[model samples]
Structure formats: structure tokens, C-alpha cells
Target chain A: MDTIIQCENITHYYGQKMIYEHLNFEVARGKILGLLGKNGTGKTTIINILTGYLKPRAGICRIFGEAMERLSPAAKSRIGLLLEGHVQHAYFNIEQIEKFYSRFFPQWKREAYYELLKKLQVTPVQKISTMSCGQRSQVALGLLFAQDPDLLILDDFSMGLDPGYRRLFVEYLKEYITAENKTVFLTSHIIQDMELLIDDCIILDFGRILLHEPTSYILERFRRFRFDSDAPAFPANDILRNTERIGTHWETYSFASAAEVERELVKNGATVSRLSEDKLSLEDAFIGLTGKY
Target chain B: MYTSLFYKEWIKARKLLLLLLVVFAAAVAYTLLTTIKQFHANPVAFWEFIVENNSIRTGYMRYLPLGAGILLAIVQLTPEMHNRRLKLTLHLPLDESKILCSMSGFGLALLSGLFILSGTALLLGLRIYFCPEIVYSDFIASLPWWMGGFTAYLLTVWICLEPVWKQRIFNAIPALCCISLFYTKALPGAYVPLLPWLTVLMTAGFFFPFYSAIRFKHGVQ
Candidate 1:
């Protein structure tokens, strides 16, 4: 896979509190990487660092093989970013906003912008301050899409968007990803909504990465097992973190191969009914790994 | 790129610019009418008026450009700072110098418009009634100085209003000191020379914020 963004040993701190330490990851081109984290988990901070808005205390972040700090205007022009809050200037009407953004981006497509506006049912003459949250998001999305950037970074793009608009945004993103073979990094709290769109997921908690893997690999490896009170304890291994007993039954979470775990359970004389093979979502994986309710 | 940024700044501050223009035009008309009335009531008194109030007239003329500069800077940047749109601006692919240049260019353009409108009204008044022989070249030559003053004032406000250094103490202290200097007659005799010096200082100061903006872009907290 062609890596588009490589973050190596990046550490960031807020005063004395470390937000992220020794973080290493690479986002491959032509794929959508969903960043899953709860509120206050430093998702926005990471995005800020990636976009060169914030500097890390130590280590390097490279975009398209160039250090983010030393990225030229030409390299920056190829990346589009949508911040979490209102991105549009309040005084700017839609037409003015489009005209303004189109100037900075050399690849900006005016026809595509107007087409997206029409598809989103947004009028170009309306002032941004007067628009609803959903409408503002549509405009921001329109601007990003029109930029046609090689790498798109969205900081919680789904926030404040209604269900219909959310689905529409997903469809548009999918189409863009397929049509242009562009890479996307999206951070969102709404994992259920992202389940259908994310090719890979990263679960972040308390300034550390708990899991990073393709969706299919996560489903195939991790299994949640439930047994009666008398079930024998699973063998200790690096993959087995903890086994908890709740009331008359016990639930064990393990990172071992699912078949191996199932066989171990059968050998231990515990009644093993293959629970539903439902895949664990990003949110479920996050909660399971973090041990947070 | 500069043209587009200039256009964006114009759109952002157009309403405030229009309002300033209207007030400026009215002030120029009033100044012209008062001067003409004095000249007609008594020719001797009119000449005396010119001599006695030459300092005041000069001060007023100087204040006109400075005040406009300060007001334009405040109005242009305050909203962007309040809304945190400045961050978005820095994130754009354009260089920091270009962004600052665009803003300064727009301010210069607005200053030019004000000068032309006011200068024309004064000339028309002179033609219609006062007929005072005035050195148009001197007035025209002084425009760049005025533009420089206003640009500096605008750039100062932009830097001061940034979230990082927006301490009330910093803003209030300088204002209080300036007022004290004005009221207590403590302003230095060298202050008059500093006006031209300030004009240059301010013109140069216009680029400082852009440097700071570049530093800000690099995440220098």
C-alpha cells in the first residue's frame, strides 16, 4: 500500500498532561481511515497536528513523504481539511465563499461546486450565518469536494448533521473515494454511522492507540465469550487481558484466534454456543478494549 | 491569489467600509462649508481664522487619516478574530505574506477612495466659493504618509486582537498612556517628528503581523 501520511513517534502534551505519546501510524492512499475516539480523547489535536495547525513536541509527521512542517504551498494545496466547528466565515454568502476558496486551491472546480450545491439543495446567495447547521455542513462539504484534494481530512464531519444529510455525505465521500482514488482521514464519535463506509479503523483512548486494523481483520480475530459460573478459567497469555464474572455467568474478552479460543473453551468443559458472528464495530471495539462503560 | 484574497477581505469588510465612506463624505462637506462661511462673513477674519487655527487644521487633517486608519483596522479584523476565522485563513494554501499583503492592499484601496472623495469635495468648495490658492501637489504627496499611518494602525489592531495576546492589560495600558500624554502635555517635543517616523514605523509594522502569522502557522504557541 502507498502511504500518504506517516506519523512517527509523535508526542504531544498539554502542559503536564500527555495527549499522545510515541504515536506511530501511516495512512495508506486510496483508502478511508476512520479515527474512532470518544470526546476529549485528543482526536482534534491529532488532526490539528496533521494539518500543520499544531506542532508536536517531538518526532515527525510527514504527508506525501514531505515533513508537515516543511511542506510547500504546492503540497499543502493538494490536501483539503474540514475542521469540526463552523468553517465558513459568517459574513460570507455561499457564492462569495465559493469564489474565495476557489482562489486558493489551484485544482478547485467551480462547476463541481455548483453541481454539489444543487445536489445538496443549497442556494448560493444565502448567508452562512443565516443557514442551519446542516446547511453550513453541506456548504463546507461542497467546498472540500470541489477542491478535489488528493488527501481529505475531516475532523468529526458527521457532527450536527441530520441523518439524511449524514447518509448523503457518506455517499458523496464513497463516490469521491472510488472515482478519484483519494485517501481520507475522518474522525468521528458516531461509529455506527461510519461502519458502512470505513475500510479501516483506529481506536484511541486516553492518549494511546488501543487497536488499529482493517475491519475484516478485527472481526476475524477478537471474540467475546460468555460462560456459566463454573467454567474453568482461560489460560493466561499476552492476548488474554482479563476475565470478569458477572452474577452466575462470566464474560471473557480475548485477542486470540477465534477458533483457538473456542476450542479452549470446549476443552475446559464449558457449554460453547457459537454466539452471533456479528462483527464488532469500531465503537464496540473501543469500549471492549478500554474497559469503559 | 492576491486578487482573490483582496476580494475576500473587501467582501468581509464592505459594510463597514461603506459606512465609513458616508461619514467621511459628510465630514468633508461640513469642513468645506464651515471654511467657506468664514471666508464670506469677513475676509480679514477668514485669513485670521486660517492663521490662528492652522495648528488645529493641521491636527484635524492629520487626525482624519489616522482616525480612519484606526477605525478601519479595528472594524476589519475584530470580527474575524472573534469568530476564529483567522485560523481558517492561515490554513489556506497561500503564503502568509500574501494574506497580509491582500489585507493591507484593500486598506490602501479604501484609503485612496476616501481621499479622492474628500479631496474632490474640498476642491469643489474652493472653486464655488472660497477660491483659496492651495498647493494641490503637497496635499497629493501627503497621501502615502496617510496610507502608511492607517496601514500601521490596522496591522496593530490585527495583532493585538489575536487570541494569544488579547490581554486587556496590554490594550488598556497603551491607550491610557497615549491619553495621559495628550492630556498632561507630557508628549515629547520629538513627538511631532515621530509622526512621519510613525508613518514609516507603521508601514513596516504592517509586515510584522504576517511574520507572526507565519510563526503561528508553524504552531509556535
Candidate 2:
């Protein structure tokens, strides 16, 4: 698999607040890579850097093998970006927007854009500003779909989407990725949908990467273990990345297997009244990994 | 592609363009109508008034172009700035410089077209009502006002493109001061002496949006 996106030593700061320090990551060609994190955890900043909207304080962010800040016209033509808030020219209606954008890209497929537009119950003359949030998002999506670039960099696709719209978006995206096998770099706080869609994921919190792994690997290997004790006894070990106790139930999140957790707890002299394995849902895993603390 | 992009920009500003042209034409017609009415009522008195004073009699009409230029910039650039649509525009496969130039070029071209039409109307109105001597002198006096419009549009672009409030204010001060240079009391061609230098400044200021754009791209406030 060839690398399509690469970031090395990406350190950024807004005034005195540091967002990332020596951050590094990569996305392989033809893979849906999700940059998942809590709010204000620098996910959008990374997107901005990659899209050349912002030059980072110090870093090398390459998209399609070219530095993003100075992206070549050819390099730029190959990436379709769905900006946050689905920003589009509010003055343009469906037909006008299609007519407008079609001239910019050589391979623009008007049919591809209209196919998505057909899904919306909007008139050809309806301006984007007048459309509902979901409809506007669809328009933004339709434009990018028509562009048909090799890389799709979508920033927070589910931001203002309702459950139904979000689900529909995810479903469409899943099909699009599968059908096209194009590289995708997306960010979202909505983890459940991301879990279903992303091939690989990077979980970030507080300007640090908590984990970077394939979705299957993390789901199969990483888990939360519950240990109950009559008294307050919370044991910490190198294997457990995070620990939290609510009432008599002491929960431990770790990459270690259930057997390893049980062994570690026994070795630490923590008496366990009840022990059970609870597979961490992606959101739960995000919470557990970042910790409730 | 360039033509399409230009067309997109034209659509954004077309309504405002129509409004500015109507208002501008109306101002010219109003001046001409009132002067004609006065000429009909008392040709000797009005003619003597113009001949003796040798001043352009359009009072508040002089400020029309300046206001039109500022408002046109607002109509053209404000939405893009407000909702981050500039980011969408800058993302196009074309060079950012080309896009910026085309967008600004569209605004400047429309402004100049309307300003020129108004100038011609004023000249024609004066020509139809008065002799060449008065027409030439009066037209010369009004050129500063037209030039003021160009300065206002250029300055407003500078202010609109700036993302930071303080920086906009900072830029506006010099812009306001620069625009004032075009408004000093003088005969119609009084600006002829200073026009060359002012054009140099205005041309330099014309590219101020690009500076703001580069800063905006770097995420600088």
C-alpha cells in the first residue's frame, strides 16, 4: 500500500495554547482513515494543514506527494475537500453551482453530482442558503463526488447532520468508498459512525495521540475489564492505560487481554468479588482510552 | 474555466451592480432634471450663475460614487468573508492568485463601467444643457469624485479581505486618509496634478487583498 498522506513533526500552537507537538501520522492509498478526537483536540487543525488553509508552525504535511501549503495545480486537482459546515457559494442554486464547478475540473462528471442532487427534495433553482442543513451537506457532498478526485479530505461530515441524515451520509460514504476505493481522510467526534466507516483510525485527545491502529485490531485486542470489590480498591499496572471506578465497580481499560488483566489484578493483591468482560464500543473505548478523569 | 469563474463572480455581484447603476443613473438624471428646470425658469439667472461662479452645481450628488463603490465591495466580498466561503473558493484547482485576481477584477471592472457611464452621462447632460466651457470645467471638478469611488472600492477591498478586526481598522485608517486626498476642493481637473501619484498608490493598494489572502491562508490574525 502506498502512502497518500504523510505528516511529520507537526507542532502547532494558537497563541499560548499548544495543539500538537511533533505529531506524526500517515494514510495509505485507497483506505478510509479517520482522525477521531474530542472537540478542540486539533483534528480540524490537522485538516486545515493538509488542505493548505493553514500553514502549521513547524511540520511537513504532504498530500499526493507534494507539500500542502504550496500545492501544485495538478496536486490540488486530485483532492476533493468537504470543508466543515459544508461551505458553498450561497448565491448559487443547484443548476448554477453544477454549471460553475464543472468547468474547474477536467474530469467533472455532471451526472455524478446530479445523482446525489436527485436524492434531495430541492428544486434546481433553490439556493444553498435556503436549503436545510442536511440538504446543504448533500450539495457539498454532491460537488465533491462530481469532482471525483483521487483523495477526499472531509472535515467533520456529521457535524450538523441529524441522526437520519448522518446515517444516510455514512451509508452513502461507505458505498462510495467501497465502489471507488479512493483514499479518504476524515475527522469526526461522532465515533459510532466513524467506527463503521473507517478502515484505520487515529484517536487523539489533549494534543496527544491516544492510539493509532486499524479498527479491527483495536476492536479485537483492546477492551474494558470490570472488577468489583466490596471496598474501594483500584489497582494500577503498566498494562492498563486508563482506570476509573464508579461505586463498587472498578473499570479498567487496557490493550491487555482479559486473562492478562485478571493475572495483573491477582498479582497486585486486589480482591475481586466479580469479574466480567465488556467489549468496548467505539465511543466507550474512546471514553475509556481518554479516561473519564 | 476562467470565463466560468468570472461568470460565477458576476452572478454574485450582478444584483448589486444593477442597483448601483440605477441609483447612479438616477443621480445623474436628477442633477440634469433640476438644472434643466432651473434653466427653463430663469435662463439668464442660471446661465449668469454658472458663467460667473464656474462651479459644478451638483451638491450631494458628488458623494454618490464613493458610497456606491464601498457598498459594491460589501456586496461582493462580505458574504465570502462572513461564512468562510473564501476558503471554498481558494480550494479550487486553479491558482489562488488567479482566483483572487478574477474576483477583484470583476468588481473593479463593474465599478469602472458604472463610474464611466455616469461620467459620460454627466458630460452629456452638461453638454446638452450648457456650453463647452462650463461642461469642461464642471466635468473636471467631478473627476475627483469619480476617482474617490475608485479609491473607496480599493480601500473597501482591503478592509473586507482582512480577517482580523484590528488589522482591518489599521488598514482602513490609511485607506481613509488616502481617499481624502482625492476629495480636496479643486477645479474639475484639479486632481490632474496629483492623479499620477495617487494612481501609483491605488495600484499598489489594489494588491492589498492578496496580502490579506496570504495572511488568511497562513491562519494569521
Local accuracy by lDDT, each model:
0.69, 0.84
- Candidate 1: which docking quality band? medium
Query: C-alpha displacement of B210 in model 2, angstroms?
Result: 1.0
Number of clashing residue pairs in every model?
0, 2
Error of 2 at A174 (Å): 1.1
Clashing pairs in 2: B140-B188, B141-B188
lDDT of 1 at A278: 33
After TM-score superposition, the amount by which residue B61's alpha carbon in candidate 2 deviates from its true location, in angstroms, is: 3.0
Each model's chain A TM-score: 0.88, 0.96
- Model 1 misplaced stretches (Cα beyond 4 Å): A230-238, A241-248, A257-279, B41-46, B53-67, B123-152, B165-192, B218-221
Please estimate how well model 1 matches the true structure, expressed as its whole-model Cα lDDT: 0.69
Provide per-model DockQ scores. Answer: 0.51, 0.75
Model 2 agreement with the true structure over B61-149: per-residue lDDT tens digits? 78888898888888878888977778888888889999888888887888889988988887888788778888887776777777788
- Model 1: per-residue Cα lDDT over A170-245, one tens digit each: 7887887778888989887777767777888888877788778887777666666555645556654455444566
Which model scores highest in DockQ? 2
TM-score of each: 0.84, 0.96
